[model samples]
Target: MGKSLLVLENLSPGRNLDAYMQSVSAIPVLSVEEERELTERLHYQEDLDAARRLVMSHLRFVVHVAKSYSGYGLPLGDLIQEGNVGLMKAVKRFDPTVGVRLVSFAVHWIKAEMHEFILRNWRIVKVATTKAQRKMFFNLRSMKKGLGWMNNDEVEAIAADLGVDAKVVRQMEGRMAASDTAFDAPVSDDDDSAYQAPANYLEDHSADPAHQVEHQNWEEDSQRRLMQAMGELDERSQDILAQRWLSEDKATLHELAAKYQVSAERIRQLEKNAMKKIRVTMEA
Candidate 1:
């Protein structure tokens, strides 16, 4: 009962789809008596072996269902793998007393998984999110006859059939019609076409030559002022500030206290007073 029903032993659809399909196809269909016995073993005794047998026999069905979703442009092997997951879930919950064949019960789960995969991988930006939108998304694809956009009558008819607003259908149609573009120009693009890339248009003003020079000059002035202020501090205070604030290996108050043979609190007070004078001098 605790073990997995789906036996995915090196049967990666992504790695080698043809071989995986052949392997699943080779698993024989279970007889009714055999199905019943396995179901009983799973339901009553929580037999993992029986669950595995039941799943193995029905893998062909998952493959069949996954094939229908090939139009979404997803890898067929990935779809089959997802459907197998759904089948396992269905088997894990299947009861001997359900009175329906495992295929009938498992169809929903299998299709649900496939549908999720399609919605996710079909686009970088999701076209469908809501329950209503999801229903419309799948239906709209089938309803569409060609590459051309749907007309007013077609939109109205689809909306009526699907029990949603025509506006929603139009929006989803637009989303499906839209294609993703890379931000930067492609390597193969010539200089003539390169200007069309978003990277060319969306320039960062902060990195402009004029702005870079202004920022660098301002930073240098600030650092010069900070150094002049530090030079005004007493030798002990300047050493503490340099070790604690300016050094790559910053000295702790306790470490400074050990070096100076003073209490940590005394070092902390000296650091604080030196910082206040530096800030005042820099601001001036």
Candidate 2:
């Protein structure tokens, strides 16, 4: 993991996505026989060289798959990198006995990684979270005819096709159409425009005395509950919890082990049990 991160850290896909794409494209695709040989060697013999070759040959395919997600407004390089990670994962799990080509099996994994990346970075507020919404988000983008808003008929068609309500389709449409705005007025804004910013008109709930008192009560009650729970624990359990979690400079398992004259694993088990007991007591 460390080695992979170090290698990928030097790769700036956003700097020159075209150049990176061209580089991956130049890598040769493996023939069916060649792929099988590599897959068999990796699967049966656990050959790292075979795995490396398999991943190298499929780098171009990752780029190809990444291209379809270009509409998400993210850099092509980032998408391709994410796809490459998916490809590597697929390669790791490739089964020679599956009776299918590696690319066919890998497409799902590759697209899944790219989809996650797109959803995470596409909007300030997530546009799609549920499995159904994710399916609709991708399908809706492709189904729409043009940049214009979908008409009533179009919305109904999309709703029926995606197995969702028309209102849901409209909601997603509105979310996609929305753009991010500054929370405060820009430096160049005049007095008139400054008042239009969210900061100017938004209510400050923190300043409300009722809210402040309620928050303070909640905090004090939580602390009281925690102390009560801690008091319920045995001396050893209390010490373990306090040293491991509540201390400014926390104690390590080995250090605790030495102090208690117990194995580090035993210390870890005690720590785990102590936490579980604390949670149970607090909840009760």
Q: Can you write out model 1's per-residue Cα lDDT over 1-284, one digit (the tens) per residue?
A: 12222434665888888877877877778889999999999999999989888888898899899888888888898999899999999999998797989999999999999989898989889999988788888999988878899999999999999888999999999999998878999999999999999998898998899999999999999999999999999999999999998899999999999999999999999999999999999988
lDDT of 2 by residue, 1-284 (tens): 33443444455567777666665565677889999999999999999989987887787788888888888789888998899889999999999899999999999999999999999988888988999888888988999998989999999999998888999999888888888889899999999788999988899999999999999999999999899988988898889889988999999999999999999999999888878887898888
Best model per lDDT: 1
Please give the TM-score that candidate 2 achieves against the real structure: 0.69
User: Which 10-residue span in candidate 1 carries the lowest summed lDDT?
Assistant: 1-10
**Cα distance off (Å), candidate 1, residue 261:** 54
lDDT score for candidate 1 against the true structure: 0.90
Pick out the ten consecutive residues of candidate 2 with the lowest summed lDDT.
1-10
Query: What is the lDDT, from 0 to 100, of the residue 176 in candidate 2?
Result: 82
- Which pairs of residues have clashing backbones in candidate 1? none
